[model samples]
Target: MGESIVITSGKGGVGKTTSTANISVALANFGKKVVAVDGDIGLRNLDIILGLENRIVYNLVDVVKKRCRTKQALIRDKKNENLFLLPASQVDDKSAVTPEDMKELCSELKEEFDFVIIDCPAGIEQGFKNALAGADSAIVITTPEVSPVRDADRVIGLLQHHEIPASLILNRLSVQMVERGDMMSREDVEDILAIKILGLVVEDQEIVNAGNLGTPAVLNQNSPAGQAYLRIAQRILGENVEIPSFEEKKGFLARLLGR
Candidate 1:
C-alpha cells in the first residue's frame, strides 16, 4: 500500500495546487506509481495544472455517487505513465463528499498506487477536513510573507490536533529579497511555523512560464524552483536529502530600488 499525503494551505494562492501537481509529476518520473487527488471540489484546478482537464471523464463525485468506479475516475498523465490524477468535479458542490468518503477512496487507491497525494483546498472548512482525514502525512505550503506564515501556523496546529504528521514547504521565496533583508528568511519561516522544513522553492519566472504551457516546472531541469520541488519529492520518499539554497543575482532593478 502507498502512503497518503495531503498538500494543504489555510490561505489560498500559496501554490498548494501547483506544489501538488509538480511533486506528483516529479515522483512519477522516478518510477513510482503516483495518484494526485484534487480535493478542492468545485474550485478544482489540479486537473488544469496537470493539463488533464479535457481528459477527465469521471470525477471524485462520480466515484462517490456510484456513477463510476474508482479506476474510471483515474486520469492517466499524458507525459508520465506512472502518474494519474483523480480530478474533482467542477459542477458538484464541496458538500457532496465527506471525510469518511475521502478516507475510503484513499484506502482503495493505496492498494494500487505507490503514493496518493491530495490537493487540499484553502481554509479550515469542511473541504479541508475531508482532505486531511485520509492523509498519513501533510505538506503545508506557504509563502514567506507574514500572513502566509501566520496561516501556516494555524494549519500546523490543526494537523497536530488531528495527530497527522506534517512538514513545511516554503514557496515563492525571493532570494534577492532575503539577501537584502527585505523579505523573511528561510530560517524565519521555519521558526514561525515551528515545523521541520521539507524544502524551499524560490520565486522564479520559469515556474509561471511552465504553468502557462500546462507543464510542471519539475520537468524543466534548468528551472531552479523545479529543482527544489524535485528535491522535496525525494525527501517525501524517505531520502536523506539536503535542501539547496537558491542564489539570485542582484540586478540593476534591486540597486535602483534601494533594496
Candidate 2:
C-alpha cells in the first residue's frame, strides 16, 4: 500500500501548502504517481498553489459526501502526468467532513497512488484532527520564529500522543541571520522539537514568484528552494542523498563578517 503523509504546521503562514505542492511535484518527477490533497476545507488554497483552481470540478467534500467519484475529483497537473490534486471545498466548513470520512478517503487513495500528500490546515482543531486521522506519517513545517517553533512543539506532542511518526521541515531559514545569532539555528529548533529533520529550506524570493505564477518551484531546477524540496522528496523515498549544508552556500565575505 502507498503511504499517506500530511504536511502540517501548528500556526498559519509557515509554508505548509507550498511544501505540499512542491513535494508532490518532486515525487512525480521521480516517477511516482502522487496525489496532493487539500485538507483545509473552506479555506482551501492548495488548488490555487498547484494552479488547478480553475480546473477543479469536484473536491474532497464531494468525495466524502459521495457526491462524486474519487477519480472525478482528481485534477491532473499540467506539468506532470503522474501528479494530481484533490482540492478542498470552498463552500463547506470543517464540519462537513469527519475524521472517519478522511480515513476512508485516504485509504482508497493509497491503493491507486504511490504517495498521498495531504495539505493540512493550521491550528489544532477539527481540521487538524481530520488531516491526521488517515496519515501514516506527517511532516511538520515551522519557521525560525519563536511563536512558530512553540506551536510546532505543541503539534509534535499531539502527534506523539496519537502515535503518528512525524518529521520536521524547517522552512524559510536565513543563513546569514543564523550565523550572526539573529535567528534560531537548525540545532536550536531540533533541540526543542526533538524530531528528525527531513529538510531545511532556505529563504528565497523565487518560491513566491513560482507560487504567483502557479508553478511549483521544484519544477524549476535553477531555484535553490526547489532543489531543497527535491532533496526532501529523495529522502522521503529512502534515497541515501546527503543534505547540503547551508553554511557551505554562504559567501566568503559573509563568513569573514561573521568571524
Candidate 3:
C-alpha cells in the first residue's frame, strides 16, 4: 500500500506547498509512483507549482461531486509518468469537502500509487484537519522567524492531538544572517519546535524563479533548495540520509539564548 503524507504549517508563506511539490517530484524521480493532492481548497497552487495547472480540467471537487472520475481529474506530470496531481477546485468554497472525503480519496489513491502527498493549507482549521486526516505521516514546514516557529509549535501540538507522527522542515534559512546574528539557526528552530529535523532549505532566489515559471526547484538541479528537498524525499522513504545545517554557525546570541 502507498503512504499518505501531508506537508503543512500553521502559518502561511512558510514553504508548505513548495515543499510538497518539490518533495513529490523528488520522490517520483526516485522511481516511486507519487500523487500530489492540493488540499488548499479555494487557494490552490500545487498544480501551478508542479506546472500542471494548464492541463487541469476536473479537480478534487469534481471527483467528490461525481462530476468526473478520479483518473480523469488527476493530471499526469509532463516529465514523470509516475507523478500525478489532484488539484483543488478554484470556483468551489473551502467547505465543499470534509476530512472523511479526503480520507476516502486517499484510501482510493493508495491502491494506485506508492506515495500520496497532500499540500495542506495554512492555519489549524478545517482545511488543516482535512489534509491531515488521511496522512500516515506529516511534514511540518516553517521558517527561521520566531513567529513561524511558534506557529509550527502550535501545529505540532495539534498533530500530536491527532496522533500523527510529524517531522520538521525548516525553510528559508539564511547562512549569512545567522553568521551576523540576524537569523535563527537550525538548532534554535528544532529547540523551539521540539521535533526531529527532516530537512533545511536555504534561502534561494532560484526557488522563487522556479515558482514563477511554474516549476518546482527540485526539478532544477542547480538550486540548493532542490538538493535539500531531494534529501528530504529520500529521508521520507526511510533512507538514512544525514540532514544538513543551513547556517554557518550557531552564533553567540543563539548560545546565549540557550544558556
Candidate 4:
C-alpha cells in the first residue's frame, strides 16, 4: 500500500502549490508512481503550476460526482511518466465534495500509486478539512515570517486534533536574512511551531523560473532550491540525509532547509 501526504498552508503565497509540484516530481525521480491531487476545488492553481492546464478535460470533482472515471481525470506528466496529476475543478465550491468523499478517493488512489500528494487550499475551512481527511501524514508549508508561522501553527493544531502526523517545510527561507538577524531563524520557527523539520527550501530565482517554465525545480541539478528538494525527497522516502547548516562546506543547499 501507498501513503498519502497533504501539503497545506494556513495562508496564501507560501508556495504550497509549488512545493506540491516539486515534491511530487522529486518522489517520481526515485521511480515511484506518484499522483498530485489538487484539493482546492474552486480556486485551483496546481494545474497551472504543474503546466498541465491545457490537458485537463476532467478533474477531481468529475470523478467524485461520477461525471467521469477516475482514470479519465488523471493527467500524466509529459516529462515523468510515473508522475500524474488529478486537477481540481475551477467552478465547484468546497461544498461540492465532502471529507468522506476525499477519504474514499484517497483510499482508491493509494491502491494505484506509490504516493498521493494533495495540494490543499489555503485556510482552515471545508477545503482544509477535505484535504486533511485523506492524509496519512502532513507537510505544513510556511515561510519564516510571523504571520505565516502563526497560521501554520493553527493548521498544525488541527492536524494534531485529527491525530495525523505532521512536519514543517519552511519555504522561502533567506539564510542571509537569518544570519543578519533580519529574519526568523529556522530554529525560531521550529520552536514556535513545535514540529519536526521535514526540510527547508531557500528563496531562489531558479524556483521562480522553473514555475514560470512549467517545470519542477527539483529537475534542475544546480538550483539551490532544486538541490534542497532532492534532499527533502530522499528524507520522505525514509532516507537519513543530514540537514546542512550555514557553516557546512556543502554551500547554500546546506543552509537552505530540512525536517
For each of the candidates, the C-alpha root-mean-square deviation to the true structure, in angstroms, is: 3.4, 2.3, 3.5, 4.6
By lDDT, who's the top model here?
A: 2
- Once fitted onto the true fold, the runs of candidate 1 whose alpha carbons sit more than 4 angstroms away are 246-259
Candidate order (lDDT): 2, 1, 4, 3
The CA lDDT of each predicted structure is 0.92, 0.94, 0.91, 0.92
lDDT at 71, model 2: 99
lDDT of 1 at 106: 91
**Can you give the lDDT of residue 93 in candidate 2?**
96
Clashes of each: 0, 0, 0, 6
Error of 4 at 48 (Å): 1.4
lDDT of 4 by residue, 1-259 (tens): 8999999989899999999999999999899999999999999988888889899999999999999999999999989999999999999899999999999999999999999999999989999999999999999999989899999999999999999999999999888788667788788888898899989899999988898889888999889888888899899999999877753233455547631
Pairs of colliding residues, candidate 4: 197-259, 198-259, 199-258, 199-259, 200-257, 200-258
The weakest ten consecutive residues by lDDT in model 2 span 243-252
The C-alpha TM-scores of every prediction are 0.94, 0.96, 0.94, 0.94
Q: Write the per-residue lDDT of candidate 2 for residues 1-259, one digit (tens) a residue.
A: 8999999999999999999999999999999999999999999999888988899899999999999999999999998999999999999999999999999999999999999999999999999999999999999999999999999999999999999999999999998898777898888888988899999999998999998999999888889899999999999999988867756345568767984
Backbone clash pairs for candidate 1 read none
